[model samples]
Target: METITENQKVRAAKKLKKMFGHVDLRDTSLICPIRDVMAVASDKWSILIVLYLGYFPVLRFNELKKKVYGISNKVLSERLKHLEGDGYLKRTMYPEVPVRVEYKLTDFGHSYLQKLIELTEWAETHKNCVISNRTSYHGS
Candidate 1:
């Protein structure tokens, strides 16, 4: 990690202490809702899935699996189901000789994906600095 100077540490401590106010560390009731919302897209697979759907208007299950490498079927299925359940995606099943299913982002999901795109760009900008910080912190 980029080492924080004593001055920075003191300033951060003061800000955190003031922000805590009367709330105990164990009392996370206030931030729980926001945390819960963020938890949905807090994983690699979920973020990739969102990005994929954003780029492609629609995609098949197998195509998604292929694009997001190393993701197990079970995990992909769970992610899709959860995203769909959370109103982030639309699942369409076609009645055919066998069966066909497609997934696409809803309007709300598209909006979220746009935000994620911004986050991705920000990360790309800081990626080198973050890697350097990690390497120095680990001393490896």
Candidate 2:
């Protein structure tokens, strides 16, 4: 496995510091908030779920699980709660015999999704280069 060099780590730290405004590298408490926010949005399944929900207004838990492959029920539930807590998603439950639960993006979530779309476009453009770099770095 390739180890990140000190210079690269320093540069990455600088970039993150600039992006996040204030981040104390030494303080665990200082880091948790940023980490939690990232954890809520940064997972592959979460990103895919957001993208899928962007195309549709709402989806049931099972439906979302179907659309997002490789996610377990526990993980999906946790991620959904995290997203909802972060104001990126809203969950509604219907009072009925069978009971229906639905998840949808909030207005805030849609705005964030727009930004994600731009980032996705940028990533798509650079994907080949990124893959080549990764392969080369991993000695594949």
Candidate 3:
């Protein structure tokens, strides 16, 4: 993988600060672009669901529930509904004997997937540093 430039790191830091600069531990408002994006993107199940959808072009509800692992039916259902409502997922219901349904990514979801891949890559590169930092913090 290609290396991330210093400029990109600085820009990301600035953006994160801007997103969280308000410093509210109790609640958040969707007042800024960064907050709006992070609000949904940083949710517990959102990234996992998006990743699974990215990996599989299309999947049924049961398949998603099984693949995500440890996600309850209720949580999975809620997350799917939330994601679909947010325009990240496209749900298609087929007129069949038993009524088949499938879920896939919308164009916006695909774009978000690309950003996630980049973030994952950045994490991989800095993983050792992160581990060292955690160890130092805990060991001291």
Candidate 4:
């Protein structure tokens, strides 16, 4: 992990406090809504779905399944619905012999993808450090 300066930690805490608006650490009421909203977008399946949708302008259900790899139909369907309901993505249905469906990111989702891209880049940079730490911790 990269070493974070005390100033950086303080700045991050200040930003979080500004966003959360005077949250008390013991108060679950204020935290729950933010946690719920974050959970929908930050789950592994939802992250993959959003990333793939960002990569490809449009994708069908089966195509997403193939790209995401190992997500079950039920979980994918649930995550897609949650993401759509939250305005991150849109789902369109076409009336045809097979009744085709397509998924694509909204402007909101694209904006969120920028954040995800930064996080993915950070993870890529720190992955080796994280692995080494994990190995050392486990060995100890």
Candidate 5:
């Protein structure tokens, strides 16, 4: 892993401050946009859903359920609705004997997926180290 220099750390901190400096915890009416967005976008299921859609381009509800294993139908339905509401993905319904529905990422979703790819790659690269650290912490 590349080490972060003191200057880099300071710059990162400054950027975060710029983004969040206006946040007032005492004001209940003010919403933290970043937190609200991340609450849906950064969850494990949403990440998998986005990644899978990135790979497959489009998928049906059942297809997404299969790809994102262990997610309950209710949760999957809820996440899909949230993702669609956030403008990350789109849902299309077809008129037929039985309705056909498909899900696909929008341009915004693709942009977010690019960012997620970087995070996913970092996680993949460091997973073993993280597990080792977790074991060490627990063993101690």
Candidate 6:
């Protein structure tokens, strides 16, 4: 395992600043909100859940769990709460003998859904080349 040193990070930041130009590191307030928004979207389950909901709106919790393999209950719950809090998803609870909860993408989430669909289409077209590249790189 290679360790990333502080000097490497500083050099990378400097290079990015030089390449991009006009970066203001002093603007903590501006940076924090962007970071938080990215944190919500960057969760492993959030994008997958959103993509799944884009295809199948109004899915039950168990159905979502089944569709997104390897996600534990606790992590799923947390991801759902985070998405709901961020207004990306709407969580509806039905009153019945046993309560039922369904998750659907909100309008905000649908915007992201469109982008995901485009990405999926692109992936579908290029997947064969991608697989070949991966196989070549891995020497398998």
* 1 against 3, candidate with superior TM-score: 1
**Best-performing candidate as measured by lDDT:** 4
Candidates 2 and 3, the one with greater lDDT: 2
**Model 5 misplacement above 4 A:** 25-31
- What would you estimate as the lDDT of candidate 4? 0.95
Q: Tens digits of per-residue lDDT for model 4 on 1-140?
A: 67999999999989987977677867888789889989999999999999999999999999999999999999999999999999999999999989999999999999999999999999999999899999999995
- lDDT (Cα, tens digit) per residue for candidate 1, span 1-140: 25779999999989887867656668789767657878886688999999999998999999999999999999999999989998999999999867999999999899899899999998998899999999999997
Q: lDDT tens digits, residues 1-140, model 6?
A: 24779999999999987754664777667568768988887676887899999889889999999999999999899999999999999999999869999999999999878877887788898898899999999999
Q: Which stretches of candidate 6 lie over 4 Å from their true place?
A: 1-22, 25-32
Model 3 — which ten-residue stretch has the worst lDDT?
25-34
Show where candidate 1 strays beyond 4 Å.
1-25
User: What is candidate 5's CA lDDT for residue 25?
Assistant: 62
Q: Please, what are the lDDT tens digits per residue for candidate 3 over residues 28-49? A: 4445665676777768688889
Q: Please, what are the lDDT tens digits per residue for candidate 5 over residues 1-140?
A: 56879999999999988876887867645666766999999999999999999999989999999999999999999999999999999999999768989999999999999999999899998899899999999995
Task: List per-prediction Cα lDDT, in the order shown.
Answer: 0.91, 0.89, 0.87, 0.95, 0.94, 0.87
Judged by lDDT against the true structure, how good is candidate 3? 0.87
Clashing pairs in 1: none
Off by over 4 Å in 2: 1-24, 138-140
Which consecutive 10 residues in model 5 have the weakest lDDT in total?
25-34
TM-score of decoy 1: 0.79
Count of clashing residue pairs in every prediction: 0, 0, 0, 0, 0, 0
lDDT of 3 at 125: 87
RMSD of 1: 4.7
